[model samples]
Target: MSRPVMGACDACKRRKVKCDNANPCANCSISQISCEHRIAPRKRGRPPKGSLRQLSQEETCESIENATADMIDDSPVNSLFEQDAASDPQATSVLEALATPFSPGTLTTPPSVSTVLRETLGKGSLAAFAAVSRNQFVPNVAHIFQKLAAAVNHQLADEGETIATCAHKCVDIFMQYLFPNTPIAHEPTLRSAAALFDLVGDFLSPEDDETPSIERLRALTLITALCALVNSAMSQGLFSTSKSLTWLFYNASRATLRLYEEYDLEFPHSTSYHIRMWQSAALQNSTGRDRASWHIHGESILLAVRARLYDEDTISRLPQLEAQLLRVNFWLMYLADKTAAAFEARPSMIPNDYLAEKLTLREQGGQDSLQLDLSRPCNGHSLERRLLTGFHLKRRLWAAAADMICELRLFPTRNQVFLANTEVDRPDISGLVERYLNFVGHVDHLPEWLQSPQRALEGVEAHVAEYQAASFWAQRSNIMSVYHCMKLVILQKCIEMAVPEVVGLNQDPIFWAMQKLETSRDFIREVQMVPFVCFKVQGEPAVSVQPFSLTSSVAYSC
Candidate 1:
């Protein structure tokens, strides 16, 4: 008789071992990880897993695995349990983290190096640290970078369109549609091949092996992600298929870990670092990897705080453009991180106290990177000014939402508090409600182009006026997405907190969720209608995924 094929966790697949298919399968359980079943095992007698094909046609079966090609990772899942892997010691630190695939927002912070070291040494003494080195354990990406860089370089060559040309087109699509609030790679340096790599810095690892520059990797990742967005959009489907773009993203994300080491160094120089992180995280989040996105954004936060981007004194000292970029950057990270937490139904990484001084400072100094304000009687303020104003309005609105997430985080865990348990301590969402209410009221104050029933894709021409007009609509569309997304998140939390014993049964939170469900349906519908010749994506900027129907999704789940 043919032996039965079994569904194995990635770990066992790498080890070429068997898995029992338990939630925390025997191997993962032995490894002490939350087992995540990704690919289904081949039917008992059916052929083993076959090569994945380009998903040109929609299949009846709906799953990430079928919708997209299998992503390639650097190491086998079984590498962690290898005797040599244990000997290397560094892998032990990140083993638990990398092994865990779920991202529901309840994840603990990546264990500190010290914490990992302690675990690594066990009963051994501190000398063990002296003996352990990253060179021995760190995954070598020298050849990988060489291959990636060559692929990118080849693409950048002037075949059909130079990598620069094609990348710019993708960048514009990313800017106009994917993230209107956050401009993607507008640096003039990107235009020049010579200056581009210069800005990316030397990416050689300690082992003297070449690696893709942080900026280079980030740019390529964004371009691929943008292409993915455009391929999904109304540009009449400019790109043929999303297969290549999606494949590129899968490969690029593998290099993300090395960038974290740069948090100890290179990340702060380019404003694009965190932006890229947010964008990549969004792309990953859409792929059902909210936890991965959250982790990536957390790295951005670490870099931002270490660079003192949050300190008003440091920000005030920055150059005009850098200062403005930092202002917007901090808030975008804040909003992105907050959304990730709320989506997975977990406590926020950002604390409320961080905003106490920062919010007022942004409202006063930052003009959302537009560097202009025409809020007064139309002193002939340009459309760009209006767009910037909308950006500012979004910053202000999301700032409130950030506060809302932080305040809501104070609630007891979902399992800790029951609907009928009034005796337990729960968080106060009153502030969240008021802030969100205030945010909702201000949402209408934005220009007409930014509000509903407005055309976002009209006026397709090369002229300045035509571009601005279209740009206005796109920016407004992005702002609306962010606003509605925030509303959905806040209301979802309120609904979750509504206990028969605490807020009482049939309460306003539940009522608001019902009401917001309509908003979500409408917003998601409108979002789908926005036409892009290249790519389209949802959530990401705020929460980093297509959170268009977060409220409605939550409502249904309940």
Candidate 2:
């Protein structure tokens, strides 16, 4: 037979796919391989050169291995491999060699180890040893602690690292130091010795997971420090300094919260102190105005505690946790108001991006400038961010309160009802349904607006009146329900206060008008009436007959 065209396997020419060729192609040998069938090569102004050809599998393997080895052996290539493998688990030996104590550029290097440990511990090491104090390793322990403390102290002195950063490192060392059975002094001893609590409080980053016990312990210590600070500051008889102490208290609380967040923790019992104060302030005030403000502040701390105590599933067990967390919920309901108060107290602290717009005509140099450089400084930006945080935090608190009340409305817990109306509701909330019906069904959002005796509702009387009128209609009976509840609550509260007739049932003209209106029909179950329980004018029952804005009436008439 004539020689048949033969060619190498297609895989030989392409870098992909393994070739099954021997000398040329095994099949080609069986069928007689031919070079004529090979793919054409490039031509240099001449006819095409020889076509593709195949080689033995051994030769091909050798060639490929040589090419790979060459690439891998290059200086740059080898260095990359070394760098990558150094971090790999398989490279333990290599990493071990590199993991020595921190040098000048290393993260683990202690800045002040020699200063603190060598000097401080040397003073006490002999005492620790003579008594067989766990100080057997006192020298070593002190060395490590001193070095770390020195490094940390040095880092803190730089002002480059924040209190937060120092707190993190300090906690890490403390945890490691305590994890072993080594005999260190009590936590308080360490705290006092290091002045750590004063420096960092209890910084708990949500991201860490070293020791739950340590985190909780540190949190308690920080709380103790805070109480001490508050107590001491109060005793100083310096309001300004006391205010700063409160700020410190807030910072300490914030730091504790961070730790609680990290270790899935809660200080429910410790938090009860604030809760009681809040409830006392809230329930004690018949006007429910100042109580509401206090309640808001109380709620914020309560929320922080609650977040540590329970997770998402806590709601499923809301009833059981409610009484305990009600104090928290109570305070949460008023956080927005508290936040707003804080904001108002430091208006200058509130960052305003549009502040430059307030510049007077003369304040703007070379008037008629198209655009002024309104950009703020670094500090200004920081203030802006802080203000934004406060604004957002308040907004979140308001939203949370609304949602909580909505949830409370559905659950109908006794504590919630008592919170709604202190007068009719039992001190213990046993009359939940009755108090709830009297307060929630009738009060609506009026309780929230009861800031300064319904100042907010009064200013927007036209709006209030519109809603109040609609509430009287059968189709929109829900509104009327809430209004009735509120009226009853206000009356009960007034009676409890033992105000004379001029200030109680007989004192409020609106109450008398409503009484008259209710008596119009002997058997009337429903009546269309005004929702204002606290009237604007006194000794003028006719004033209730006229539609008056709560604000204008309260200020002008009263």
Candidate 3:
């Protein structure tokens, strides 16, 4: 048989199958096609001694100059590898030495002791420490790069739409469903950030440079967190497969946030604070009352306090738009803090004393101490203004409810300690009853427009009525659920506090139990009024069911 040829035939190479290296290979012969070897075979084995001649001094110098020119070129691919190589001196030096040319007669220098040690020990050295100093000093730097790589890989592997498209959709979903209720982020700012993010081809692209700026990092953090939240919300009903994507975005947001914190530790800007606040909201929605959610909520509160977001005087000194955004942001935080504290049965991170002082100052100023100012008024009874007004009213209600929860928390301790004491020695049952009555009265006194969705849209423009109606219905449902839940908690606590000996003497446990049943019925009615789509799309049932469960447990215990 003839000796086999050096390389595969064209047909076998094109099909990527093994070749017999015959003139007409078995594959092509079987298929009745002509076989060609037009492509050159790769050179194999080392060249014989003296087969290659070293370049002259001038030739070596010219080659070295050409290599240096290529290295210094501002090309994108070159710069990317350069940036990565720059992180390690050993790698950079090796690359440089490989690129340099030498004359034939030039004497080669012996390797240094440090170089020998490095080669022997294989990367265990103080130099490695110095090389990774950037990662060591900056929090989450390594993790951020890892996430960037993963995001890039995911983008590359995705056969469908791009991240930019998904990001735009997430933003739209967030603005439509969540913005009116939460509105922690400024609308224009969020849109602008999304627009800018769309322009980024790759997060670690050479065009973006070696290091990202604080502003870029902040925008990335916000976008990722927003996507995570929207994905989490959508995963509830629209897309069953989105849970993994939701967590992917969530973890990316966390990594970006840690990197941003490392760079901007001293002054936590509104954007960073907004990222944290929204992250906490996402955590609450995705994970429920987890410790991570609680910790993130606390971090946001700390950022707000540090930024003096709670101080009206400080807020008033800013531009009108900024002041308005900050005002809404702070109030949103306030509402969330109270809700988390009440539902989680934990002490609120926000200082009640500061809130009390603010109320006192407002009373002294002759304003309605119970009502929080919703900042600058819009020109007309616009939908945004109405929604803001309603949200502030809801915030007031939650504040009251949280106060009751705190008082109820103290009751168990007091009841246990003063078991044999009179009712006077225990937490004043009358005070608790009074607060419950007041909370109920507050809900009853809400404006007709806020209480009813149809009333909210009575005079709205034709173009905006749909949005206004949706906002009103969502807000009303939220307020009513909170109201009914708070009522159940207070009444249940009242029943618990009513000692068997005092039940007949002071208040009737049967009456409180009956009231709880009534409130539960009202809650059910309100829940039924909401569209079934709302329960599925917004995960409303998951949120509302927890309170019902709590009420059930309390009733069984009683």
Candidate 4:
């Protein structure tokens, strides 16, 4: 057969079908198409803009790999990466080295789509995918994200049931460990959502029916799955905890927040808002070495204040039942901020002047109507109510301890020295110490049910005893830590005044100082046994104390 010419006619090219060797080609003639043989001269600077040839798969891959390499070398990503990576002996990340044009033993072949996908997903470059996916019906990467979970599971899974199973497992993991500390996303609601999700999964898979709800529900399920996956992996190995957990949770949380921005949709605030709080808590606890959730805490504070969290009058306008719930919620947020500040030696976001509704133990004289009365405590309301009351009481004692600790550092400045002998500061410190001690005595005298771990939940609706126990242990551990820390700070600050002469032993003062030191040591030992439980102060009396967010409305009947 005669050889075909290098280029085809315009008509044949546009049609994208083979042409006959004749002047009018068989394709054009059969379809009654017009064909022209005229050729236009191309300019040197830029080729004619009519129509560019589509690249072959090999060429496309090569182009992408080359362009990516160039961008890495010339773009800001490369600059930032180098700035951070330059500290290493090789001065390059594994990724950077792999991408280099002439790296020894590195693959120089054109990258495959699978390769691209893995690289995109594995590196911090998931963000670019996230940004693309943030716009609805966007071109390019949007569909990639939409189908990301399915595509991933598709490879690892044989059928739809596996995804449903994963979804359930993740929900359990979340509810068990993290959810108890902060039920940001309400558990019961998530339970219902999961049910709906299972239904959605059944409809779309095997049945082959698809719907918009499927998409949204899928995103939500993916979030929990990612969260649980991270936690599960982190629990398994501490060495890679920070790196892996951080990556997984970031994508999960990004997908979560992106749902709101891209779809203009979010789970109802009743649950979603709290879930966000849980995310923040996890991030704070994500890394072993890094325990501070400061940035997240700070963001939460600003948002809370904007929502008038500090305004009791605004909160009181809600239904009497909800008003009580809201009050405890805000109180917990306050304590969280304060605890963070105290630990970091930073100023608190909760301004000292702000008026938080006082939580009071009920007595025969109901003098304080505004304060929550322990007599008609929140225990009887719901399971969460029980937690609210317990946490509120505990946090009050913590705040009291905090006040005593603060008294010791009256003025923190270069020239400021705490003078124990000063008449004015002396009584302030003495009185605070007395108050904290009395408060501990009061806690000791309180009813057993209030202080004991609510494992049986005999009257409560919640069941996970382990989760409750963990939450209780967390609060109890922190309380003891605060107590010891306060005692240590107090005695250490005043040891100069407590015992002036070390040689004579000054009988009473020396003995008292030694006793306080011993108490501090004992508290330290207790904490070591429950290291994870008490690391971060679950200052939120509402959820931290009662992870489920609802407990019985405990009454403090006089």
Candidate that scores best on lDDT: 3
Q: In angstroms, what RMSD does candidate 2 have relative to the true structure? A: 31.8
Candidate 1 has a TM-score of: 0.53
User: Model-by-model lDDT, in order?
Assistant: 0.45, 0.30, 0.55, 0.42
Q: Per-candidate TM vs. native? A: 0.53, 0.21, 0.64, 0.52
lDDT of 1: 0.45
Better of 2 and 4 by TM-score: 4
What are the per-residue Cα lDDT tens digits for candidate 4 across 356-440?
4532312112121222223323223343544444555656665665565454444233113335334434222345456556545
Write candidate 1's Cα lDDT for 235-354 as tens digits. Answer: 223333222333333344344333334332443654445344544443443344344444555666767766777677787877766676666666666665555455545455665577
Local error of candidate 2 at residue 347 (angstroms) = 19
The 10-residue segment of model 1 with minimum total lDDT is 57-66
Clash tally, candidates in order:
16, 21, 0, 35
Query: 190, model 4: CA deviation in Å?
Result: 2.4
- The TM-score measured for candidate 2 stands at 0.21
Per-residue lDDT tens digits of candidate 3, residues 1-558? 655776677555444345777877787777788787764554444557667785433233333333333332333323433564566453354336422111111123333434444543463544532322222222233334344434433542444655666677777666555554565566656665667546654544421122455566777788878877776666645343344445556656765665546444456666766677556555555554445655675676777777777777776666655566656667766666665556565556776677766521110111211111224122135555565666667767777776776677677887776776665475556766666566776777666666676665676665556555565666676667767877667666656665322122247656666666777899899889865544343432325556533321110000
Question: Which sections of candidate 3 miss by over 4 Å?
Answer: 1-161, 200-210, 338-344, 351-381, 411-428, 458-463, 499-513, 535-542, 548-558
- State the weakest 10-residue window (summed lDDT) of model 3: 361-370
Q: What is the lDDT of residue 491 in candidate 1?
A: 60
